[model samples]
Target chain A: MDDDGRDRPPVPTGRSERARTAALEAALALAVELPYPQVTMEAIAARAGVGKATLYRRWRHRGALLVDAVAHRNARAAVGDGRIPDTGDLQADLSAVLRAVVDELAVPAWDALLRALCVEALVDTAVGAQVLEEVFAPQITLFARRFAAARATGHIDGSVGDVEAFELFVAPLFHRWQLRTGALDHAYADAVVRRGCRALSP
Target chain B: MDDDGRDRPPVPTGRSERARTAALEAALALAVELPYPQVTMEAIAARAGVGKATLYRRWRHRGALLVDAVAHRNARAAVGDGRIPDTGDLQADLSAVLRAVVDELAVPAWDALLRALCVEALVDTAVGAQVLEEVFAPQITLFARRFAAARATGHIDGSVGDVEAFELFVAPLFHRWQLRTGALDHAYADAVVRRGCRALSP
Candidate 1:
C-alpha cells in the first residue's frame, strides 16, 4: 500500500470519514438509480446531506468523484477483489480469480458506473489516468506478486515475465466488455485462464 | 459480401462510385489532418465537393462515417489483412500474423481513426456495434477459421472450441492498446502468440 499507486484519496479522521463514506454511498446510490449523465454533483450533495462546496473541495468534478466512488468500492470490497487464493495450481487459481472478476463486474450497479467512467476516460486523458490508477494499479500490483510467486513455485515459466504476463488473465475480459465482442461469463473466464496458464506453463 | 452487414450503402453505377470514394478519401485525409471532433460532416462534404445532405443519407452521423471510412479502407486493402501463411508450424504462423496485426493497427492514420471511433463507440451503442463490425468482425471470423485449421492439423487441441479460442490471439493486444498499460510491438505481439500457442497445445 505504497502512496505511489494508492489512488484512493486519504479519508479525513473521525466525522469527516463518515461524511466521505456518506457521500460515496450517495454517489453509488445515484449512479445505480440513474444514468451517469444524470448523476450530478448537486444531486449527490443533496443525497449525501452535504454542500456542493464540500464535493468541489474534494473531487473537483462529478467524473473524478464518480471514479473514486466506483474504484474505492472495487478496491476495498466489491467486484475486482485483488485477494486471489493461492491453491498452488496456477490454472485453477487463475480460473477462480477470473471467474470472481466476471461476477464482480457483472453486478449492474458497478457495471453501469464502470461503463460510464470508461467512456469518459477514453475521451479525457485525466480520467483515463484515473481509470488506471484507481481501478487497476492495485490489482495489477497484486498480479505481479502472484505471478512471481507462481514462477517461484514452478507452476509457471519464468519466461512469462513478471507483469506483462498478467495480461493473459485480464485483456480477454476487457476485449469482450469494451468491444461487446462476446459474453463475459464463467465459461469465457475459465477459457482465458486455461489458455493463459497453458501458454505460461513450465 | 452480403449487404446485411454492409454499413456502406452501395454506390450507384458510373459517377456515384467516384463520388463515394472521394467522400471517403476526404474523410480519411481530414481525419489525419485534424482531430475527430474538429473533422465534421460539413467539413467532409466541402472537402469532397458533395452536399451535406448526401453525407447524412448514407451515414447517420460523423462517427459512423468515420468508422466506415477506416473499415472501407481496411477491407479494400490496408491494415488487418488476415491472410496468414500456413507454414504448418502453427506457432510461427500465429506469431507472424499477430505481428502483422500489431503493425497494421499501429499505423498512425488507422490508429488515430480507430482511437477516435473507440471513444465515441464507448458512449454510443450504434457506434460501438459499428466498431465491432467495421474493424473486428472480419478478423474474428478469420481467426476462427485459422484456429479450426490448426486444430485439424493437430497444431492445437480439438478442445479449444470455435470462437472463444480466438480471444487467445487478440485479447492481449486489445488490452495493451486500450489501456496504454504497455507498448504494442512485434516482441509483445510474438509473445502473445507464443503464450497462446502454449496454452492451446495438445
Candidate 2:
C-alpha cells in the first residue's frame, strides 16, 4: 500500500522493535532475579529469546546493555511532560517532582535494577561514567532547570547556588535509598522539597 | 603479664589478632588489586597467611568478612576528639566534621574497602542493613545532634527539620565521592554547609 512496500505487512519492523523491548525487559527481569555478578549477556539473550550474536551485535557488553535498559525505563516513567510546571508556587513544583521520583523508586523492579547498576558501576569505571552521564546527570539537569526557573521568577533567593540547591534537594532521597537508612515516602519527599524551597527563600 | 596472666606466650588463641588484622588488610588490598567478586575468602586467607577456617570462624561468609573489614577500617580512621567545636558558629562545627571526613576518605585503602563493601551491600540485604546501622546511621545521628545544638543556640531556626537538614548538607558529599561525580574538596564542603544552614533557617 505504500512506496517500496511489499505485501504481507512489510515484514513488521515492529518485530525488531519488539525484540529490543523484549531484550530490555529480559535484562531487567534477570537483574532482579539474579545478583549483579551473576547476570550475563548469554543469560539475557536466552531469556529474551534472541540469539547471543543478536544481543552482542546491539550492545558491546552487559554494562552497555543494562545502562540502555535503565535509561529506557526511566524515560518511560519520568514526569513533567517535558516542562517543569510553574504554578507560581516553587514548593508545589518541587514537591510534585520529588514525589514522582519517590513513586518511580518505589517500584520493586526499579529498586532492584538501580541497586544492580550501582554495584556494577562501582566495579566498572566506564560503566559508572556512562550511568552518571546518561542517566543520573540528566535527571539532575532537569531539576536544576526547574530551580533556575524558580530563581528567575523571584520565588527562590538569587543568592542560592544552583548546583548546591539541586544537590540539597535530591541528594537526600538517593542517600536514604542507597544507604537503606530510612524510608523514601511521600512524607519524606514533601519535607525535602519544603525545606529546600524554604532555604531558597529571600 | 600484669593481671590475667595464664600465659606461656599466649598460645596464639588459635585466633591471632595479628591474623585478623592481616586478613582485613589483605582483603582491602586485594579488593583494589582484583575485582570485588573475585576476592574470595580463600584468597584473603592465603594472602593473610591464615587458614580459611580462621576466616570462617570469624565471619559467616565473604560478604560478612568484607563488611567487618571495611567497618573496622572506617572506625579506626574516624577517631576524633569527640568535640563538635562550637566557636559560637554552626558553620564552624560543620566545617570541622566535613574536614575530618575529607581527610579520612582520602586514604586509598579506605576508598577501596568502602567500594568493595558498597558493592557487596547492594546484593546482600543483611550486609546492607549492617553497613547502614553500624556505619551510616551513626554518622547521620552525629550530624542531627549538631544541627539540634545549632537550633538550640539560636544560630539556626529551631523549626528547620534536623534530619532533613543533615541529609541536605551531607548526602551530596557522599554521593559525589561514592558515585565519582566530583571532587570532595574543602570549597565544596564549605559551600554545602553555608547554603544548607541558610536553607534550614526559619
Give i-RMS (Å) per prediction. 1.5, 1.6
Score candidate 2 by TM-score against the native.
0.83
- Model 1, A1-202: lDDT tens per residue? 3364335544656786777777888999999999878899999999999989988888878888877787667666633554566777777877877888788678887677777887667666687777777777767877787788898888888876654778888888988887888888999898788778777778
- Alpha carbon lDDT of residue A57, candidate 1? 86
lDDT of 1 by residue, B94-119 (tens): 78778877887787766677778887
Segments of candidate 1 deviating more than 4 angstroms? A1-19, A78-82, B1-12, B104-109
Task: For each candidate, report its DockQ versus the true two-chain complex.
Answer: 0.67, 0.54
Candidate that scores best on lDDT: 1
- What is the per-residue lDDT of model 2 for residues A1-202, given as tens digits with 9 covering 90 to 100? 1133211111236777677777888988888788666779989999999999989887779988898777666655546226567787888888888888899789786688888788778878888887877677656667778878877888888875666677777788888888866779999989888777766777
Q: Looking at model 1, give its docking quality level.
A: medium
